[model samples]
Target: MSREKLLEVQDLKQHFRTGKHSVVKAVDGITFDIYKGETFGLVGESGCGKSTTGRSIIRLYNATDGDVKFRGVSVHGKKSKDDLRIFNQKMQMIFQDPYASLNPRMTVMDIVAEGLDINNLAKTPKERQARVHELLETVGLSKEHANRYPHEFSGGQRQRIGIARALAVDPEFIIADEPISALDVSIQAQVVNLLKDLQDKHGYTYLFIAHDLSMVKYISDRIGVMYFGKMVEIAESDELYKNPLHPYTKSLLSAIPLPDPDYERTRRRVEYDPERDNDKSEEPVFREVKEGHWVLCTSKEFEQYKEDLVE
Candidate 1:
């Protein structure tokens, strides 16, 4: 709810009930602030609830508990239709599976123009067509491709169409939920670069969710690490990669493959042993290890980290 913050998520929780009354904690008490014009990356394993967190922020799924604030306004408490419409125009989402996100039957133009139609943003058919073409070109697609269906495009192209559709509404915030994961590895970079370019040009803020560490490092201004639906660590990109504090974070970073075979061979992998869970029971609570670097873990780890800092 700060003036400088574009989005503030406070202790967000999302739980799904199963048949036996068991609950899957998809997102559990995660909190973060995203400033305007910066990419805040959420990185974790596939089921760590990164995507669900993104969806919850955009109101795609209602949060079981907590608050999501946009520009000092609470999205969860908004009751006015005009306010909701303003929020919709300001926030947008790009889905993981491009093929499924886009309507297979709709023409590219219609797909891109759908937001404009729904929002009544354009006054005439010609204006809508122009807006669609502009969005297509912004995502590196041609205006001629507007008449084609989504199936006619490749995975990367389809993803571009998805980006265009999101862009059509002229949004200030975007939740890119694994935007390049489904595409070929070679094509992944292209999509990422395109997104970066668009962000740079428009000064857009993004909550980029991905399991790929290297890609997240490439696009994110800061990175947050999640484990079992909980955020364990968060820091600037370089700081997190170079000096991860949490045991889970260390383990996750250790798994990233190095390009040099010699380096890869010599690098020690951090093992996550359930037997070693005793570390969580001992002294410092979740405390700041350094400026802007936060770690949520056992008191012992915090004390040890603090000791290291003092030393």
Candidate 2:
């Protein structure tokens, strides 16, 4: 990973009005940065706002507060259509559900060429077709499948098509929201390998959102842990795995399936009590306990975390 910053999400929040006087804080005051050409993994259980964080960064959901900066430009709101177009061109998303994301009415070519069409990137029909064909090849598909609809392909192939669509405009960043979660166990590795190959070739920065901790560790240089709409820990992958600081993180690591049957049988799962773990009086802020490692904790908790690391 390079030292250059690509995307910065500062205290980002996404709140939804569910009723007359009630608001659901889907994401509350989360902060992290995606470095240039690095895959930053965001991991958490479902309903922890990992998907919301991805959507907010891509402007699918306008953040209710705080700012998301892409290469130092604000992405939240009130941008001109032209500016938004540029933002869309620069950053793209590969949604979790291939079935829901692809248009059954549209052919693979049309779906893949959607971004190009929106940005007016191609000059002619032939150019668009050529671009679509190229993108299909890029994602391990072929021109022969261009005329087919979404329903015709398998889950993995449909996801490849989604990857193709995200790459149509040569985007600098891609928000892959649980891209592999819907696929078979065998196919998951293939999709992830494809992403890694693409990143190596094109130097694409990724916000890889998933609940799969082991997969995240394999793909991401750095990982951030989220819980109940809050970012609890952020660190280099190996560092986080070897020395997880937060109670929630320890519990999460404990749950990861070990390779050995002996170890698995003997391993004890660390039970996390959210009410017991988090202090209500003073909200914790993310503090760096060591170089390149961050954890959210109150002042007293920070000292304890530091001491724990030392021990």
Candidate 3:
């Protein structure tokens, strides 16, 4: 991973007022950085605010607090229409649901060319058509499919179209929000591999948000674990899996099932009860227990983690 930061999210918070008195903190005070030309995977269970983080960063929803910066420019506050347009061109997002994200009324050509049209990337109609076709092919779809509506395509094909649409603007940073989660098991690997191949060819930076740890490990240079709208751990992909420091992280890693029958039978699930594990006396803070490995813990727990690592 490059030392250069492409995107920086500091203390980002997104809260929703569900009722007059009740509020939901979808994302609360999370901080992380995505290095240029590297895939940073954000993993957590559903409702853990991983997806919310992506949406807030993309400016789909206004954050309640904190800041998000792209190459040193703040994305949260107000900007001119021209500036917003430039940010939109540089940063694109792939939504979780292929069926819902795509327009049922529009043809694949129109859908993929939407970005091109908005940004005026292509001057002529012929140029636009050619660019759409090229993007379709890049995502493993045929030129013939351009005339078809989103409803005609299968889940995997629809996702490819979504990817094509995102690529239309040639974005430098892509936020893939559970891009493969809705696909079939067999199709999931194909989509993930396609994303990896595209990143490799284009040198695109990614904030890959997903629940699948194994796939995250395969694609990401660095990984962050989130729980209850807060980041619990952050480390290099292999390091996080090998030496998970947080209870929640351990619980998540332990749940991944192996193919072997013997291993499956012997596998133990670690249940993390926050009420039990979390020390009430001291507020937990994100701290580095080892070089490049950070975890949210109280000072006492931080010392314990470091000592345990030494043994």
Model 1 residue 206 CA deviation in Å:
0.4
What are the per-residue Cα lDDT tens digits for candidate 3 across 1-311?
43999999999999999999999999989999999999999999999999999999999999999999999999988899999999999999999999999989999999999999999999999999999999999999999999999999999999999999999999999999999999999999999999999998999999999999999999999999999999999999988988888999999999998899999999889999999988778999999988889999999999888877722
How high is each candidate's TM-score?
A: 0.94, 0.96, 0.98
Off by over 4 Å in 1: 1-3, 274-278, 282-285, 307-311
Tens-digit lDDT string for candidate 1 (1-311): 54368999999999999868789999999888999999999998889999999999999889999999988888885478877888899999999999999999899999999889889999999999998988989899999999999999999999999999998889999999999999999999999999999998999899999999999999999999888888888999988887877777778889999889999989999986635743645542456888888888676677776665421
Which model is ahead, 1 or 3, in terms of TM-score? 3
Off by over 4 Å in 3: none
Between candidates 1 and 3, the one scoring higher on lDDT is 3
- As for candidate 1, its clashing pairs are 283-299, 283-300, 284-299
Model 2 spans with C-alpha error above 4 angstroms: 279-282
- Model 2 collision count: 0
